[model samples]
Target: MRASDRAYATLLDEIQSGSLPPGAVLAEVEQASRLGVSRTPLREALGRLGADGLVVQQSPRVTVVADIDAGDIRELFELRRALEETAARLAAVRGDAAAFADLAGEFAAVTLGDADGLDTYYALIARFDAALDAAVANDYLIAALRTVRTHLVRVRRLARDNPQRLAASVAEHRLIASAIGARDADLAAHATHVHLHNALESVLASLGGGTTTGGAITTQGAA
Candidate 1:
């Protein structure tokens, strides 16, 4: 990565890892010093972050990171579920053979209980999602899914705490990949909904009654 890109990636990593947090005001000088980069490159980094919806820009001030709330997380997940269900259905019908091949490999890696495969699993998920999104071929659905992904990233960290849930998620990913490979739109949509529903349950369980920001957690197996 270029110097500016490196700095930008570093900041984004910190943000996603919960080190910077939502609503935290970051001083450019401190960030530049911390990242061992010049202020100019740091500024460039922040600009890109802003564009990615990871940061917010305002008049007469440096950009600020967006604040996350339970409502925001909940709504984002809801949108993701809706959009992805549609995308999976379309991808199944369209039969993008190359993308399906890639997704199959990712699904295999995710099903394996190896430590190093986790990152690869997530990367495969991103690629799978992008491919599905492309197959959907609706600009509005594509745009909405992008917004939902930004906030859903926050809750994703919580998902790591539950091994069983993660394994289940991988299984669900495999189902969608396989179903899409078979050109089964109905099955793809159903599998996508089922997986996302379980994920929502897991996330809600993790945040249950912790704070007002995490929202409602069902003790009665709501899923």
Candidate 2:
């Protein structure tokens, strides 16, 4: 990989993992030296991160990780609901039913009793996402979903300690996958909506009620 790509990947991982938390200063000279890269490539990486909304230039020379709060999380979920619900509907019409059936089965079997199991469950989710993208076969939609998922990784880390939420998520995903497998586009979309609703609630609760805005969609029987 190029130096800039390497730097971006490292910094992105650190930021998402909270190793470099919000508001952490990223001095170009210091960062260049730490990553064994020159200022030019580091700047390029920072520019890409800025485009991704992960970093912000405080002045002409100083940069820092962007802050994420309740508002940002709420706005993110709003977009997530739109994109994922649409994706589920499209996948139900265009995707391979057998594949989604297998995924549903996998989701049913998922166990999160330990760290390894959690990792496995997330990996399975990744596979499901890949399948959705392939089934939808829409470049523009997939691109948007990718952007939502970028920030979603960080948001997910916030709710990692909630075992009940994770278990609920597994069942929710199974319903969605099963609906898609059955070629029930309406049900798939509805399931996606319900899952996102519950997910947003769980995440906001994990934030200790930090996102108190009523902008989130109100749903009945979440989870």
Candidate 3:
């Protein structure tokens, strides 16, 4: 990969993983040296992240990770609902039945008993997302979903420790996958809608009295 791509990937991972938490300052010279890249590529990477809305410029020379609160979470879910529901409906009609069926099986077997299981579950979600994107075969829709997913990684950490929400999410994904595999577009869309509703409610509640400053985010929304 090019140096800028390398820097972008590393920074993206750090931001998503909360290693570089919201409001964390990213000094150009320090970050460039830390990532072992020159200023030019580091600037390029930061520019990409800024475009993604993962970071923001406070002034000409200062940047910091962006913040997420109740409002941002709500907006994110709104877009997620529209994109994912459409994708599910289209995938139900045009996707490979066997692929969704296989994913359904994987979802059914998912275990979230420990950290390792959590990692496995998230990885499974990534696979399912890739399959959905490929199956839809719509470049425009995929692009929108990709942008939503970039912020989703950060939102997800809020619910990472919520066992009940995680368990429910697994079941929800299984149903959506099963509906798609069965070639039932209506069911797939309805399932996606229901899942998103539940997810938004859970996430808002996790926001604790709908306040961003309350405890660690308590609910995990869909991927």
Top candidate, metric lDDT = 2
Clash statistics: count for each candidate: 0, 0, 0
Scored by CA lDDT, what does every candidate get?
0.75, 0.90, 0.88
Give one digit per residue, the lDDT tens place, for model 2 in 72-143. 887898899899999999999999999999999999999899659989999999999999999999999999
Candidate order by lDDT, decreasing, is 2, 3, 1
lDDT of 1 by residue, 8-121 (tens): 888888888888877777688888898899999998999888877778865546667777555555666667877888888878887686678668767866644676767777
Spell out the clash pairs found in candidate 3.
Answer: none
Clashing pairs in 2: none
lDDT tens per residue, model 3, 113-150? 86599889999999999999999999999999999999
Q: Against the hidden true structure, what lDDT does model 1 obtain?
A: 0.75
How far is 14's C-alpha from truth in model 1 (Å)? 1.6
Error of 1 at 156 (Å): 0.9
| TM-score, cand. 3 vs. native | 0.90
* TM-score of each model, in listed order: 0.73, 0.93, 0.90
lDDT score at residue 25, model 3, on the 0-100 scale: 98
Which regions of candidate 3 fall more than 4 Å away from where they truly are? 211-223
